[model samples]
Target: MPDLHSIPYLVGAGIVLLHVIGILHVIHAIMTVRTSQGTIAWMVSLIAAPWIAVPIYWVAGRSRFSGYVRARRSDDAELLKLSDDMHRRLREYEIKPDDAFGRAAQFLGGLPFTRGNELTLLIDGEETFESIFKAIHAAEKYLLVNFFIVKNDRIGTRFKDALIARAKAGVQVYFLFDEIGSHRLSRSYLNEMKEAGIHCSHFGANRHWWSRLQINFRNHRKIVVADGKEGFIGGLNVGDEYLGRDQRFGAWRDTHLKLKGPSVQAIQLVFIEDWNWATDEVPDLEWTGQEHTADQVAAIIPTGPADPADSWQLVVAEAANSAQERLWIASPYFVPDGGVLTALQAAAIRGADVRILIPEKADHLLVWLSAFTYYEQTIPFGVKLYRFKKGFLHQKVILVDNKLACVSTANLDNRSFRLNFEISGLTPDPVFVGEVAEMLENDFGNSEPVKVSDFTARAFWFRLACRVARLMAPVQ
Candidate 1:
């Protein structure tokens, strides 16, 4: 037998230990991974290269966010009571859903479709920020501000100054941001807001030792509420690039929704949960609903990894399945999971006017490449794809038949479906649907139809790269 002190013996023992650990991880992945493709992929990689795959699997493989769930369920009696009170107050304004998609959404989100809401579609950065800053400035009692990214650049400074001004005016301002998304945000930026008496904290997923290696999950919801009466949610973050100031991606196209009425309270509830997760304390804010003159019906759907199932994926699939006339979706990232893809194809096959609008310019190379691989699978079933030519399409808007429209922080990818904490504003009001339809019509007018040959006609290396990128979709 080899000596235990020898380097070669130690090396052999290390290899055995790694393989044993890899097998354990493989077991964990098999028991926990949500998708079959992801399970098979991890099984192969873990067995073949335990040293590399083990570390990666440790970081990105886990599907459940136990820490978040624990935070939500912990002895937080006050938070639970606040949530119960908010829902109790919203019960009077709740509208029972009559359609399949609506029912699915209501069941998945645990929030009812609320009436007496007025929704305004804010297109692009200028309009969104203008409305948000105005709300911040006008906030008299309190403000709830949260975003996935908050930069230290010009727009961010403007946002900071707006909050500071309000805090100085005696408004109780609470700010929350994703640590991963806003890693570049300086401590000085947060200090300034703190000095002005604004409460600030990052959605600290790494606060616990067990969760330190789990960085795949992110809080991607963008929300701002003023006095618990009006609110904003969508894809726009606080950055100059979002305003189309970056030379690399000019004319940044996006969308946000402004809400006035009971639904604003729903948005506020989401913020409360996130804030509670970030800083184990509940803020004092209004839980009552305010009726708007327009009297529109809307629901706020929040989804995340801590959920019982893939909520966003189910919502999108249900939307596709329930659409009878048209289903138009706009997102920068177009990579979809198998279930969602099948739903889209089935929607097309059932004679729905299925159209997917994606950006012509890519901000994420892997996700963009992965999108191409799906054309052959979808185009054959009459699902049409469009590439926005005027600018980069960063909006996450879904229009279902002329009846339902949604502006959400979630994207049409596995990341948004499974990894990120996201919120959506969904409405079935005719006037609001008409507005969304008009907005999408203008967008389609500026887009070019994509042909299946867009992928088939590409070179062998390019096609191979797309397939390789697609294999990484679960974590992307």
Candidate 2:
């Protein structure tokens, strides 16, 4: 098998490439790094087979993005410190489900599901803006605004301008955005905020190829809180498309919320943690005590790789299991995890009305393909699925018993469950929950359901390719 004939020429080419790399290294020291003998041993593994070795490093190497990684893992320490306390609060109550997804109620959303929380579902984008701005206008101590996509466009400009204004007004504002997801925003926009005294940080930015594991970890949550008084959460973001202004997406359908209660404090905590991670700026722990409104709040749930509460995943499972009359699901990306898919199928098999509505054409094709491959298993379990024929459906919501549900930033993929930091609000309030469920039903009615046999009988190779792609899918 040895082809000695061309070995000399191939060797010559490798030598040329190495020379170019050496020259570049001399120019900028981009790849050159300080090292010790032990460090040199670790470095050798990277050069031996970079492509394969790089990925392994990513899965196991140290993260240079996490500011505290060099110090100590604070998330772990805080989690352990409060583990016993969190356990007691968790054991306080059991979830109640008559016919919907929470029938078995494994999550135990505490004893008082809707007891002290004052949850409000905001139906108007304009109203959400006004509410958030009003809270920002009323900021006394600190303001935390985090978003995945913060463009320099119309809505984004306004939000940024307000934050800048608040910072100038002596309000402490921390802004956290994803590096890759929000890459479209120009340096000028960020500079303007910095000039105005706003403390900003980008989640997981530049790193060497060998040290860039979990680089895909994103910050997908959309939240805005002012002095922990008023909190805004849900699917809406700072984009005209979110406000139904996109010419292509006529009459955009989306959902957002303004939560006022003790839960808002929890939302603020996540922002502070992100701020600490990105900028190494320790936020005031007592900042949580300052509330704009002393309203009763619900879960105040946030989840990600750094936190292993699994509150988001468990919430989804409970919602699916508690499905009563119907379970309506709508998400831009519908690639569910094992526990989520199981609970959904089980609910349908148990005779709960289950309908899943996803977009026919989304911005991400791999996600769509993976979701489509599960039609056979899901449909056979009595799960009715619909595909939106219009534009992308970026909203993530679940309706169970038309009484309890959630609107979340978390996707069904593993990235959302275990990697990316995300936020979601789960509520048992019938009015808002009913609205969320009914809205999903309207979306389902606007689209066509997937024929079970037809989907199962697709071309073998197409299905096979999709199955293969599924292996590469994001995981928790």
For model 1, how does the per-residue alpha-carbon lDDT over 53-151 read when each residue is reduced to its tens digit? 998997898988888898888778898898889899999999998889998998998888999999999999999999998899889999999999999
Candidate 2 lDDT over 130-229, as tens digits, reads: 7788888889887888888888889889989989998999888888888767889899999999999888888653334543455556678888987765
User: Backbone collision count in every prediction?
Assistant: 0, 17
TM-score of each: 0.98, 0.75
Candidate 2 ranges beyond 4 A from true positions: 1-53, 56-115, 205-213, 247-250, 285-297, 309-311, 453-468
Candidate 2 whole-model C-alpha lDDT, 0 to 1: 0.66
Model 2: ten consecutive residues of lowest lDDT = 29-38
The alpha-carbon deviation from the true structure for residue 60 of candidate 2, after best TM-score superposition, in angstroms, is: 10
Kindly report which residue pairs in candidate 1 clash with one another.
Answer: none
Overall lDDT per candidate, in order of appearance: 0.93, 0.66
lDDT of 1 at 409: 98
